[model samples]
Target chain A: MISGPIPPHPRALLQDLWLEPEATGLAEARPSLKVSSSAKKKDADPTTRGPKAKASQGDLREDDPRERPPYQGNLDSEVFHLESGWKLLASDLCFGKGLDVDFLGMDANRTPIAVLALGEEDQDLCPLKLLDLKAWFQRNKELIRQTWMRICPELISLDLCRDLRFFLIAHEFSPSLIERLSCLSSFDLLLFRLRSLGVRGQQYWYAEGVAPWAHHSQEVSPFEAPSGVEAELLRERINTFLSRVQVVGEGLVGRSLDFEGDRFDRRALIENELVLELGVDQGQVWIRIPGIPDEFLLGTDEEQSRVLDCFLRSLMARNHPTWGSVPLGNSPRKPEQTQNEGKALGGRPEPQPREDRLSSSEPEKDSPWGRGNPCRSSKHAERSEGTRLSDEEMAAFFGS
Target chain B: MAKFFDRIFKPFQRHVALPSSLVPPVVGIASGKGGTGKSMVTVNLGVLLGSPRARVRILDADLGLGNAHLPLGLKPDRNLQYFFEEKGSLADLLQHSRYGVDVLPGGSGLSRLAHLNPSDFRRFALGLDSVLEGAAAVLVDSAAGISPQTLSFLLASDLVLIVTTPEITSLTDAYALIKCLALRRPGRGVSLLVNQCDDSQQGWRAFEKIRDISGRFLGIHVSFLGAVPGDPAVRSALAARTPIVIRTPSAPAARGLRACARRLEDILEEIPQWRKVPSYGRRLLEAQR
Candidate 1:
């Protein structure tokens, strides 16, 4: 400390004089001594390092750890613990009778589990391995209990036989193996895929349930997407209204609205003859009578009601004459009387000239039933042989 | 505890009373497996029971593969398909046969009604209500097997006739059908009719076997309706396009059918007059309402 340059301090002079060759020679001459010296250095100094030194010193890590080699085969036991809550209790557990388990572990529920790992090439032997695991567990239940107790003393009192579960872990499972394992619901199947990290012996392991994939192999129709709320509401309203109105001759007639198409035509028939045609297009109801030239569009309530009333009255009059005799709104005659009327209608030998009978009271030419009917005329009477009822006749029959 | 008590006491629950006007006996004819002549039995029975005094309406409820009209030599102008399409009333679908039986025909491919949604089914059932208004007895010929459509008809009927042959497969399937029915309706009684048997003894043996199995496994007693012997005349009458009971009244199968009809008539008479309710269709429609 007493000189022109302080003689460069003895430590600084020693550091500058020591070259790479001398350091190499010294390390070679005393390898153990040098290691022990470095170890001592690390232990003696607690807080005298740069940021990098402190960071490296805080955790004793190597760029690569020897224990974690690249998992070329099935995953190491620790990967399962990290991924699926499998705590390895023991590895290569053996009983005295030549029975051994690959790995013995505990699940998150503290249930003892036996796992067997198979490489892709050994996937065919899964069933054999499963059988072996089951046999080993059966043969060495007491040994497994003791081993579990030794590893986890807190769970020592757990029932090993009742709570034991078995799992098969493999690199890749064939579809056949998965199908076979799916049927064996007692065993859990885990499939692993290996991803190489930057390090030589390290990997990222992914595992999934193979049984679920096998169980859900059946083809299913995709769910139909729901119609929007407004469309559904409109449909519900239409259905409600249709349910209320009486569909005349509903069971005897064969007419349906083709809702999927742009236009639909339904021909209403009485006695196997088309009497009225109904068409629906662009939210409009079209009514067409056989002899009428104009198509009536039922757009409003009054129009719809009028058309429905006309259609029902025509049908009633064509099907039953007793409809005219029954008082308006009173329950139609008893079923027996209706049957009698039907019989009488069928048995009549000649058509009653109701127009002629009314002609004495009112001029026949002025009567719609005789001459002025829109649906029936002299030509139509000649063609239909008088089977068809005129609109005026139907009206007279309906007492309207 | 409440569930346990309910399980124990469920059988003791009283049946709700039904109105007398809605109580016409509905006889459902069914076969577990196809091609066992369920429709044949239904048609013959209808013909045997048909009269001015006894109004018999045969409803061919076989929505698919209905051939009830074939043996009658009459083509149906209208069928249940018309009812579903809302073109005709149920009354228009009613056809009168020369044999005095009223036939409500079912179409061959009219399977839409078989898969009807609840609302459409209700409407169809209401249509049935009007058709069944004046019927004294309605015999429903249900489609073969235990399909939901067939089961609905069977469940709604007052009496069920299970028709089967002496063949082993037929007997086995018939037992399966009976098992399903017994599981669903424990207290409902079923009658068995063995057809195509070589003789009365063979039919009786088959019936006994089924009765034993049903008693042991299902704990249900099956009533033995009379058996119809295998007769070449049945085939002959079928070839002639006529019901065996009508065309060949003296045939062996016809005699057996007459006996069965007589027995059914006796049973109907034995029922208390007050218990005679309206038709099943009417009751079903009323229930829906």
Candidate 2:
């Protein structure tokens, strides 16, 4: 995946993602994104590549962040730095040159994460900006991983380059944006809610996970949650194959067979290691072995059975003890095609009531329990023409 | 209890013929928790009420661990063991103290007495009429906890008094017992007597705690009879195998017991004619079914 070299200066690459021209003034300790000097030399002959960052970052960020720019006055971004099991590698770091991304950190898994905040208004190009930035990260993930590992020393694992997660912070999101984002399922976007307390000017802040979701690597019981509508659709799609899976799984004695949302997994009951997993994402069914990181897209029945059996026997033969830490792979997504690949995922949240849904003009809605009865709120009545009475009949009542 | 009544009402109602004269105010003393001086209160109340004008008999319905006789300073040659065996009668097993309080000794450590079947209850009630004869008031000392057997005895009585201490655990259990009684028979009010209190105020506070909760949640009245303050004389009297009231009349607990007895009399006076006249034996038999 490390096909091309990055720009001579990391800040220039960062400008392609998060360029804030108005935010030119310097502040105390605004850390820059660090890349090894060797990577800079190898990737960019900076003289030629300089124009691309200027074009994309400048064009995309023109309309955004007009209303509420990222944290003004006494507001600080320190709340994003989790205290335990996390390391803040670089703060306010730029990738290519002048483009400054927000805080950059590494999670417990040593996965490099880039964070960006969308302001309250003027966020029209957030989706496009994020998608393009994700493409940029994907193109240069190998360089970022290798260089960061050499400098940071803590990132020992080889699999750290598999994903570059993002934290896109905003007070709220629009529903259409959320739906559009859900259409592209591979991008790992875990939403978080931040609560601020204390006086207006000097506020204390804390962050909490808004949606209960599993990590990209489903080692921690994968639902890798899809909030509300998507969660329901995933459950429904997976349920369509539950009986068949159960039939196939019944013969396997020492396996922990279970289905959560769109993913069905079979692990050794003793080791709790992933043996086989089936899941659906945007109508694509992909399978992968725990020890083997390759997500094998399933084809025909004969091909699936052959590939699945071969992987199982291989897993049995090697039986790696560390396989328990491997992520769950899943559903028969659409025709095992390439449709799921390269599909961009970003903002798609509409502010919804967390409890009993309010009544709306929309025809019918699924009950909170998904398969339960449809909401039967009052419906609009049909109108009719008023009947006219004769003068004699009217006079009988009036005693005329 | 309803099912018990359903099964036995028709059968016993038709078979057993009864004279209406055996109705004295039946006061059942129960505590949801044990060791709150329930038996002591029963014995003291029995002694205070027992007289030539108004005779009182203590029914040791704490059948498994009956100690009413122990406090009354009486040893029974024949306890409920013989009665359950169908060898001796209930009235015959009744032993009287020097204070004129009659004591019915229940068999100690007898698991059979802990859970009485419908048939066993029927056999026991065979002698209830004789025991009730000429009695002005019958004080039933029921076993602690809301067991079906214990509940039958308590529900069958005209009045139920929950004897509890000032301790929170004791109050909670008392509340649980009151809740059970209120649910089983709504509007059938239960009285609470706080036993072994540090002071009168402590007892009153405990009573108010239970009364407020039971009245609010259960929608049934929990009457506070009175609080018996703890006194050293009460322990001495119990050790001497005599009720505190008889052993030391000036004792604080004895005085509180007397006051509660007076209150009991006033409450019993308002009892309906039907309640005073129900055949305790047949009702218990029905409840046991």
Candidate 3:
């Protein structure tokens, strides 16, 4: 089988039905559609009486025979090269085996293309005919190459026929024909409506549809490096930040700091348990503690104050003795005094009474920070105190 | 009486369980995203698994854009499309490559084969049964992502080998594929092979992260097959149109692949006899429904 839907014409349907069975047997028995090389001279002559008789016997009969267009005989092949960029290599390039392409030409990309022109008078032109052309091309690419080489040896140096494209130039394409052509994506087939315009007795042929070979180049250009003073400043800032951060995991690169880069969210192991993910969005630095739902923004004063105080308090409470050796550029104070004073200086809401704080902690049974009445323990109270520190104290603690 | 009944009815069963030797385990290699080296792993593993005493066949199931034969340095004249169209048998399409592997090439740009009807699926399954006869193992290189066709292949196989790189995107996609597979075939186990790793440690770390997340969220166990290190020789071999295992057998990636192949062989050997039926095509057809 034929894989796609058939056109509505009964004759075309019948031909399509018989195409598969006859594809091999008919290869030898079918008559050649190509104009014979011996008949080239006669076909080329505009003054010859043969095409006039043939045109009259078919559809091109005018009211008077003398009113026939001047460029009537053998003009189908020449019309492609008149104004179109296509340069014809051979006309009626015969395979000599009942198969021939109308015009063999090279596109701008130096890719070989087979052009088949369907005349209005040709009764045999159908979807099955196009299929036949494609099948013949597939089977005899080397033969077509040899014939082209025999005709013009120098043009063979351009490129071999790795992907030969087919073009059907017709007066009008039926909807069914377009549908049939759409199914043959592998062939890279193109259909063009051949528009014949007579301007001041000059016949001009325009191939109107987009050529398959004329697609834009799909090559991707390398990304250009960022330049200018702002870019340099941003790069320097990001580099400085990354150089200061400690990256401690296997195969873990330094936390990427550049906001504009694709890997802006940098993850680094903190305290050997928590993952510190730092990212920048809209010129504001944001930090997220992975496995925790809370996000800390470091761009604004209030958020910076809250996050820094919380971090320092958590560290100090968790490792109180090691807190003295942190080199935070400040003297270590008692955990109780640091918690009380940090909250007082930070302009945060006043802490509830010790009993109320203890009561609130009861409902936080599953909190990662701790379970049940954190204020009941002096260590938990100190850590909670660290979460409410002043902006100035945090700035001073970091020596920024 | 039991022997007489067995003799009378065994030949008439629709689901005939062939001998384990005749019904080689089908391993489907897949990825969540494209360019994760699924085909590369499948081809190299086929070569590693093949020996004088055993035979391995690779079926290129990436219908539209298959390049599995590229590494083998064989350009097949016919492919699965010919077999699908009845122009040739599955045996006719099997091309022997340089490294003692049989490849059933998936012809490029044949989109029709990506989706098969019921009859076509039966024909394809029967064709595979004939092609895979007497093989020790059959590796199916599936197209990346969770397309219906890829899912069908994964569902049909006895095992799925998910290939991924250390990149976050690759890991995320691999997880997505595991999630999809878990939702569809919850009982099936998938093996993870991290490709292009900086080291075995890095590969293990990536695998652990994916495994932990999958276990916690999807409640599925992902087996760690192993990792193939990123080696320059692999790229050079690819450019030269050869498998790195054959071009530079001692290279880090090749050695890693050999170790992975051994692990896979051990796993295949442990499979029970009842699961060794060559019914991947039938399973795939049922999955498609």
Candidate 4:
């Protein structure tokens, strides 16, 4: 990762790679494989079109299950679920998933570390929650700091947080949740916090009566402003989001400060509400609030992304425990019993047929997927959509 | 299961699917004056070279007046004016000729397109990319006289094929076009095709006069691409609303056009890496943006 400015030609160079014979050949080859696979599977199963065969495929049966199938293992019963940090954020806070998130999983550095699958299936109504999240972070402050130091040795030159990631507040949440998480040493360098929230329900239908943003709106209804409790909650969420962003630290400040060259009067600096003039001083990023006469040296875009990543990890470790705060330390519940009681009951769990899966599984590959008619094949479309959405989230975070 | 079955079986519907080849090379037929048979050459040339796989898209770029389709005895469903009508993409305006060629009928509205500002130009280019992506070539039949819009079309193209008859007036006008283009782009390619030439000697004389003068004075290389014989079959084909190539395959004009197209193809193959350079006027706008 050299730090000089990226040449404009690099965009064209990347385009060339996508168009190269090897790349195009691979793209063409994929559909052929899928076409053959379906043909083969059809040939192998004489009753492939029968109801029994469809049942055996388990698409419907799996959809009906009210539990976090066996693999999830009473994560609801856990004392600390890493996903609580996410729940603490406003429900409407807009977060998009890119391709990488589904692949290289997010890490929470506690002893029995956990990974949350904010995968496509669970993304719409994320059920994971944090338990004793606040106390745990306060107790393990040193470990959290050490973890970030080890993971990101050169966090000074990164800028992933600014360009690739942002949170649009959905609704306000408990102050304790926002305050405890925001208090972390990291989570700085966040720019462009859009305050408005547009909410819609399932009744909203477009072509063919299908809800495009089904995950966010439960059903696809036309976009409308949030109201009543949702509106109030959204306002608080915006406040907290803005408050958490204003907490300036060494790494976050480093991202905004232009220290490449020149020097100026530090005290003469004035923060015009919308714009902040930042410059570097003695290899440090200084912060000046709107009313204050000081300048902050926030590092570049790359540095800011790395610091935010650290904050997310620490927050995940303290907050998320099990299915809705059932700390992982608790005794496991019977699978059948939990199946009858879990909240993943109502609302569609599976993605719609023919929707692109690459948007979920491997988001880094998002650009190429949208270019042509490659998604015409239902098989490729379904598989790509199911897997790609998670990868998109991760890619968004890293690339975000 | 029924839904899955339909999805899996859908692609098999096409009985004779052919791999799509690149679009036909767009050869814009332009000249320095009217009645030079620019439209006649473009129509007949397109008909002469068009194949089932390599489809020709003859764009009538003439502003206010266009006769490429009429001379060829065809009427398009929607002319080039529809391309700028804000309602449709270029894809919707494409009309296929009976002879297996696609024609973008030019209209007076084209002048407005020529005056598009920077943002409009970028949007226009993206639409053009979709239109040009599949065509082997786009033959822009530019209006007679080098107007600003006509110059834009000429400079934007990969090859500027200038058509002129054997008369002294035609030769001088053709030479003037070469001189104008030479002053602007001293190193660019300019092909000369003698349309309505009574004989090979006259055609060669016209080509030589233009080529020699441009080379000596302007230091420009004006190539003699090929010459079309002034044959009665071309007039009869126009009267019948059919291309000479389709009406009489052995016609001297048809034969000459095919040869010219082949030579143009060979020249294109020589510079396989020569990318489609955007119009210089458009580039200037982009720089400002």
Candidate 5:
């Protein structure tokens, strides 16, 4: 079995290894191999649609916001399993080092099912990931059995599993990928087009059995990436999201605004008591909590997200007097006050209370921004003249 | 299984996929030697490029040994390890810094990603494109040096901004990296950034030195993309985990970073529509091969 590398011919680099005139001609010589009998049948059935036909639709783009499926959930819940006839043992099962499956459970036949879901962005690599996962599962059958038993401890003495089924869900499976699936005869491969249907303006994701005729598809709702425009969406989404989010806090350090940069630390009177400094410059929105010293950007991702939590609470409390009427701690809104229509946030809608609309907007006679703050100097009074925050914005700020 | 891995790990097609107009320009920040302030410059540029019209992302490509997250005062939950190990996706790992720019924090001090093979590059790069789903621009803060891994990244990008300090070794190494890229990809756009300069003249002189040599010997014109002067304010800002440009806009280095960012933006705009190109991962695999 001794072997050595062989030298290439001198003109190898100049040769076009990919394309050949002879190969193109050979296809014509063997027409049957190039064009299947199904192709000729297509002439008889003009209504038969292929991937190209489905893809040509103007609004069918995978990335188009209009084309997004209704439901945006993991589809591993009891509601989905009852609807789809599958049992989910776990979501996001991890291997010791590298490999992890998106889902693992059992089909109706008690046959173990492993699912790998990908989105339109990862459509190209869907087949490859499937192959990798299949290979891993085949090699580590005992590992799977061990984990399966661990999950279902009661199913101990009996033979835990026999046939393993792999399910792949994506927005759309390319024709080539389905064609490749034909060769993978040994594995019980189930391909589905991830789908969603709106139920009263709400999106609930489900799996649709993919057939040649079922060309339409979508991935399990991929969280849309946040862009500059999405930042505005975040503001709108946060308004509904933060309506109920509040903090039980006390003192806010009153600091003078540095009148240098493009943004000014303008005082916002939410009601008449609590004052919030908002950062809004040329349409960019951010919130600043002066009481919490977040001078440098020294904050973790968790702490920053807390800013979104305190957004409505801090913004709404801007005008409420801190000494008397201020809602500090859990004293502001009782759980009973929020018995109204749900306010939508991040797709999941929370009912908003009509009686308790976050806060009462009654104007105070001694409003700081509306009337002259007799307590402050004239310079401080003039600083609050212009309110830049159209609505309001904040960072992972208003740090608690 | 072998057949499947082969297809997955296969190199690029003989001809590139046609370059499309929608392709966002990915810029790589590289320095041949350490202590060239590449990460600092990358973070600042990311901050400067943040605007209403465009979204910017800084990819700390330093792998296991990265500190790009430190400057922004971010503690990311997941790093490159999480992505490579399939524990998390790129979006799950993104740390939205308080500065408005998103930071794709790199793995810190883990040898797992230090020796990535071609297949890994392919997987990582393909995933990198999804980050562009929201962002208009991505700045790859390449680790200091011309390692095969680093070079693969430099070649995958549309533009390479080589950051160098006034130190002789830094300049020499920067030239070395540029030369390597020039050889691998002839006439590849290489921009020069002279960091830690005493003044604009010193920065310009440093740029001139590298640009002249590369032009004379390599016969390639290297762009001098302005310079950031040495300032004590940079140190103060670093301590605060805030970029100097945001902290002290009047500082010399802040002004320089702003100018460089604007110049880079112009260069990005001037880029002629390329024929459709492969995804970043596919390009990475091609470069690795």
Candidate 6:
């Protein structure tokens, strides 16, 4: 349906609609109007250009930062380089902080041919179509396939993914496209944060129906199969993810599922390089990786065990610090064993008066942490130095 | 003709077309920890205190790893790196932000600064002073830890704001930092700002240990400036790359930062009155001689 004359000065109209102070929602919705006229056409002409043509038209005044004057003040010399590129892109870099995905269309030589700036949350408020790619390449699939093959040297071949090349679905994704791109792996299609995915979110796998070889086209192969370096990186990432999950679990009491167990399963997937499992229970999500044998850790290295031991210890400290430290490998705590195991420990304490601790002497030295005392020399240097405020400071600090 | 001539030379009479005497004292936010809320506080406080005429310049001194642009949601047409590389004056590197505040991004490829002779450091300092000549206040967010960059910038600034969280480790490190600065510049103008406080009381209590220890040992009183409460809104705003002062000014954390800004004002007013204690660096050199 026509929204009437479509407001000639669309950005101006958006500004008028958004400056209300209360118009934040509409303000955030402004970037959508920048999409090309082609996006507005029904599968109709299949021949209209988008961001490129519009970009040339200079309709995206917001994107052209030059309109803003350069800062003219005492500036640090080195930060100038990053300031230009560190902009809030019209789109989210990753959708909902889920996956990190890169779509690089390359040439026959596998050189960088084209980089796709995928739809970000703010940019594509409305649903988007993968078919947009056809427009992106001007319906030149063969070239795209060749470029894909060249870029994805590890993938089997582009021809195999012809059927699953690209498709579109009417769906809405939350978080942002950038975040979604961060969590994706060809072998693993798990959603890290299901809560942020708005309704109608679904995966459209272009390589779904293709043969393993076809799906693993040289262009898409690297994404399909893990490389030696990638495998190692994934292992480290999985360990980090497991640690973060354990941290998250500390706050979850009687959660929907065993987050820590699921983390182990994901680690297993990375270890075995076979079978990916993604599931959700209540609010907790799980990705039960398969194929790793139970004997993988028959005699784990001291370093690996130490890391695990430290991780488990931190989790216990966070969840049940007073219950007493549990030794690793005694079998996970059962529900009965988990209850009322110990007193509350490791919890942060309340703020108290501290300035009085100082002697009102000649030096005016008031470091409660003993900034200069020779008597406490050995004990002084070991403490972390991050600032924490006193009670009166906090009160008067925020009260103003 | 006489009046016109007088007006023409009026601006040059002062030798510097500096900002009004009412200009607020520039306070820098620094930390020994990486993940502390230095940038967050600096950006928010700038917005709170910023005005068209009395503008606040947030100089991101984190250099190579600066993230002030991320929290403020601003993208510059040119960054400070270009200025440093091209021998551009600090004034050349200043970039206007979407928010009303002005910005002077730190250089990223400052490995050169690492090897810079004293001449280069002097030129850098002069460029910065020129660039900041007319600002109402300059809020510097320094790189984490005691790198040369952080120390150089910290020493150059009029006031230093040390940010830390409530963890014991963080507090301990904060005290060590105070001790370092005190030992280096015994009476350096420094203040403490606590972030991610469980409560107002907790924030103050967290600084209490450091305040007392520093007072008793170092013979220095690092002012307990203020604290920002642990607010999820701050994180969400950061995730979205928006400043919370604009997104949710009424939030506890925002309010806290504003209060700190005010406290900073009061502290700044008292600076000239406080005796300048020789930085320990100077004292140590003298002692060695």
Q: Write the per-residue lDDT of candidate 5 for residues A1-400, one digit (tens) a residue.
A: 0011321111110011101112223223222111111222222211322222222222121344344322212111111221112344443344532344545665434555666654444456655666776677667778656764465442233223445667766656777777676456666666655444343344333334443211111210111112223334544543432232222223231222121111111223322222333433223444544233342121345655676445434434443322223333334443334323233223444333333342456422333222112213232233223322111111101112
Q: By TM-score, who's the top model here?
A: 3
What does candidate 1's lDDT look like per residue over A35-153, in tens digits?
A: 11122233222232222133224322332333422332212221122112234444434443223444556543455666555544446766666667666667767865666456434
lDDT of 4 by residue, A1-400 (tens): 1112321121122112222223223344212111111212222232322222332243321343344222121111111111111111101010122111110111111111112222122223321122222234346545534553244332222222221111211112233433453333232111110111111211110000011101221111111222223334443543333243434321232222211111211111101111122222223444333222333334555654554444333222321111112322344244454545554675434322223452356442322111111222233234334322233323422344
The positional error of residue B49 in candidate 4, measured at the CA in angstroms, is 2.7
Top candidate (DockQ):
6
lDDT of candidate 3 over A279-358, digit per residue (tens): 54434456654334577765445655565455444433333232312334455444466568767898664333444554
lDDT of 3 at A50: 23
TM-score of chain B of 1: 0.87
Q: Return the lDDT, model 5, position B89.
A: 78
Deviation in Å, model 4, residue A305 alpha carbon = 65
Q: Per-residue CA lDDT of candidate 2, range B73-146, in tens? A: 78788878788777867878888765547877888888878787767777787678778766657899999998
TM of chain B, each: 0.87, 0.89, 0.88, 0.80, 0.88, 0.81
Q: Model 2 segments beyond 4 Å from truth?
A: A1-400, B1-20, B272-276
> Which wins on DockQ, candidate 4 or candidate 6?
6
Give the per-residue lDDT of model 5 (tens digit) for B1-289: 0011011111111012222224556789999999888888998887766532244678888886888888888987677887888887777888787554688887888877877766776778788777765455678898888888898888988888999998777877787787677667653447789999987778878877786555433434466677788999999999988777666654678767756764565456444334378766677778888
Sort by lDDT, top down from the best: 3, 2, 5, 1, 6, 4
Write the residue-wise lDDT of candidate 2 on A287-356 in tens digits. Answer: 5443454676656667666655655443444322223112233322222132334233334432233222
Summarize candidate 6's per-residue lDDT along A240-281 as a digit string, tens digits. 555544443333322222221122123211111112222222
Alpha-carbon interface RMSD of model 5?
27.4
DockQ for the candidates, in order: 0.01, 0.01, 0.01, 0.02, 0.03, 0.06
- CAPRI grade, predicted model 5: incorrect
The true-versus-predicted C-alpha distance at residue A227 of model 4, in Å, is 77
Q: After the best TM-score superposition of candidate 1, give how far the Cα of residue B8 lies from its true spot, in angstroms.
A: 43
Which residue ranges in model 1 land beyond 4 Å of their true spot?
Answer: A1-400, B1-22, B276-279, B282-289
Model 4's chain A TM-score stands at: 0.15
Residue A24 error, candidate 3, Å? 44
TM-score of each: 0.38, 0.39, 0.40, 0.37, 0.40, 0.39
